[model samples]
Target chain A: MTALKAIDKTTINIEKIRADFPILSRKVNGKPLIYFDNGATAQKPQQVIDRIDHYYSYENANIHRGVHTLSRDITIGYENARAAIQKHLNAANPCEIIFTKGTTDAINLVASSFSKRFISKGDEIIVSVMEHHSNILPWQQVCEEKEAVLKVIPINDAGELVLDEYNKLLNEKTKIIAIAHVSNTLGTINPIKEIISAAHARNIPVLVDGAQAVPHLKVDVQELDCDFYCFSGHKVFGPTGIGVLYGKEKWLNQIPPYQVGGGTIKTVSFEKTEYADIPLKFEAGTPDIAGTLGLATAIDYINEIGLDAITTYEHELLVYATEKLQKLQGVKILGTAKEKAGVLSFIVEGIHPFDIGTILDQMGIAVRTGHHCTQPLVAYYRVPGTVRVSFAFYNTFEEINVFIKGLEKAIIMLK
Target chain B: MTIEETEQEIIDEFELFDDWMQKYEHLIELGKSLPIIDTKYKTDDKLIKGCQAQVWLHSELKDGKVIYTADSDAIITKGMVALMVRVLSNHTPDEIINAKLDFIDKIGLKQHLSPTRSNGLVSMIKQMKMDALAYKVKRE
Candidate 1:
């Protein structure tokens, strides 16, 4: 935190880490790749890529259905992935972890399954003003169907959650409280533990959207005491089409399955059907076998590198980016949360976010532009969209320098 | 040109693409050959809303035909604008409005475009159609 505590904005060394990612070695319009769009999805590590390749080449088979050698091996690999995720979130049981298509699907699963079983008319669902559309829309559907009310917790100008306002929103009627552990657009890290506690006092179940937070920080579900947690594999250093939903066993058992197909049933007949228990009940059809294996591999890779080291390094990069970007003329940095992840959202005066993104692209530096799937939040900020540059642990200070130089050229070109 | 003549010309020109790319050596060179608007046209008022590059577009219904003039701060975008002008210009507003440019795939333009760039192209094309529609409404 001291790196951010002191305002020392200097140049960064991008080439060193650029060598690690093979994609970054390529040319975009005759320039090397400088991808800063980690918030959208982080690039996969070599190990994760190889693991997926290995699965297809060697162990491709249907899981939990067949008795062949490949099937048994595939099932083991799949379950190992679940166990790895259990460790990642520090869940009480492996069965508590359910595989989903991605964070969006995972949140939708909770909204539909849990709400249908437990929620009633006049119940309320609490969400923050900073949530991505994925988090907001699903709960909104549930609220509409059940005739329940949806409430929002307002954020300060600095993008930090208004905890006092959040406390006021919680009441006996509040049945579910869903929030992003880290704001994707603003980089604000919410006080999830306190938020969860506030909801728990009212006996409300809380769900933490960890899509942005899980990749940057260490998330302990037991420590946060959140009833549900969901994150996508692609947001981390893993493959796409895979995500994790961690819920308490009691709740998982109480809720029905989101999708139904082959794997979810224990025994099926035209007359009657018996559904498989807990995690299997939620999973449904054939899962993304290779994606889960790749995710597990990514976890191993992260563990090998060490989470503490990654966080420390990312903190240093975030500070470096913030200080340097602020010094640029006419640049307005969007979020200044006391606690943040590795995100820098800004807009240059007289330059649209799209223009900034394109100019950067020409220099082989990539950053995400527009509302970033948080249009309501963008509307709330009264800006069309922001050019968001997010950092991964592998990104270096030198890359930041190249990005700054590219941005300066872009600004000059536009002005 | 009449809408029928313009379609025939487009068909004739598209048939010459193999020779063009062969002679030009790069697809971008062919893109650059398309006529472009002047720098004066590139303004905030004319700027395309979703492009990563600064793009300005203006369209006119001259003699019942749509004539599009556009420019961009970036080279690739300028090239894209030029290409769009070549395909869209000298055609009846109705024809231009109805025509779906399959030539975009032939040129492999979208592959070179980033997702935002692709979106910008869609927005620009949408704007052109809107202008054509507005013109039709005014005439009626």
Candidate 2:
């Protein structure tokens, strides 16, 4: 195993962090809950929950274009949340941040609008095999609609993308390069910096599916120079049905509106109707006001804890888990990439992943099982599915030990 | 023995195990002891869907009794199927069709089965009854 940097224990108070998430203390099936399903969705902190509650309890009002005082206050709060996200992503302007339902929604918006404007028949879109179905299906749909071709970048046995293969697939016909910043199944953090630069050299815009990346890393859209970056709120300890799609202002101005309705228009007459500017042009009708507030608060929570500290703590935890799991007999981890995030996928010999997950659940350990929305990747591995354990900064070394004990017991039972 | 009597017997057998580990060990032993289905019977038509594990179930009528043969890729699923076959097979078509097989709940396995596995179990039972009904109609 390659040596990992040791995290400073003083940087993060694990106990205090755990206290922020109330669900961590709950019991499942008479055992203490050991949540290792952060990849699926993270447990919310008290601050985010309270933020949502406070929004509905006091500041509940429809945002934008209202003359009432409550509406003005809510509109300010909602727009402030957008600015917060813009700052978090380090985008040049707050208008570059377009709020959507979630990561899937954000991807669909880009796939539909951008493809309609830029892609023509026989045009090609590049994607990686390691993408979640959200990233794959949208491009597939656009390809089908536009009669364009979808090219997939293959992966190595270690779950890292074959950069040579990716370069070979890219050509003059390649209109856009859509890929995941991190594989939710393999936890391989793709070199998005390299990917974006390569695509940019070809003058092809790259859209990064940052659903799994935003939770664990500090994302700077300007630094990566990605055309678009999108992520969900729920995966980062916020409420569901809220996400951000950060697009370059030039690209945003070029792409047409995905959905048209109440708030997304400038002037509507029997004649030609003018659309609203940049961000408002994309956001239509009433949005998830409470969810947006909660997401902003979640971002604030992460900022307070600090992404550097969180990244350090989670990296150490992943290394500890990988080392311990590798030492166990009959256990085979799926992804062995040199660089990875919090996801750990493995299968025990002579034991099915479902059975192992079931046994683990009985012991109050929560781990995701099955294809994890990456069926092609699972099929490539030649397994029905895998047992996935994803960690967050809130998780402790002690919790990992409990998970190891449960997993060992499960293996014995199945064997 | 009657189907109810067989179910009660199986429930009593499960009662001997205290912990989930011991119960699962008994299940693994039962799976190991299950009669293997002929390779020809393991086709796609006999496959049960919605299971996390692939399960193939086949049934035949012999001397007015319905006999079931099944296999699963997962051991626990195989064991569960084996228990079903042990309880429901080698019985009259009418008995096989109508039998409640309440022993799954009595043995504390119902709560333990995952939602998908429970659905698979239901599909397994349904397929056996459908086979019995076919045989019963042919006789009539």
Using TM-score as the measure, the top candidate is 2
Q: What total of clashing residue pairs does each candidate reach?
A: 7, 0
DockQ for each numbered candidate: 0.14, 0.57
Error of 1 at B85 (Å): 7.2
Task: Determine the iRMS, in angstroms, of model 2.
Answer: 1.5
Q: Please give, for every candidate in the order listed, the TM-score of chain B alone compared with the true chain B.
A: 0.70, 0.93
lDDT per residue for candidate 2 within A212-308, as digits (tens), equals: 9999999999999999999999999999999999999999999999999989999999878999998999999999999999999999999998999
lDDT of 1 by residue, A1-415 (tens): 2343432222222354345567766787677787789999998878888899999998899999899999998898899999999998899999999999989999999999999888899999999999999999999999889999999999988888899999998888888999999999989989999998888887889999999998889999999999999999998989999999999998898888888988898999999889999899998889999989988988887777666667767888888888898899999988788888978899887666765675577577889987888877888888868899998977878899999988887776655
| Prediction 1 global C-alpha lDDT | 0.80
Runs in model 2 with CA error above 4 Å? A1-4, A269-272, B91-102, B111-119, B129-140
Write down the worst ten-residue block by lDDT for model 1 chain B: B19-28
Spell out the clash pairs found in candidate 1.
A12-A397, A12-A398, A13-A397, A13-A398, A14-A398, A14-A399, A354-B52
Candidate 2 global lDDT: 0.91
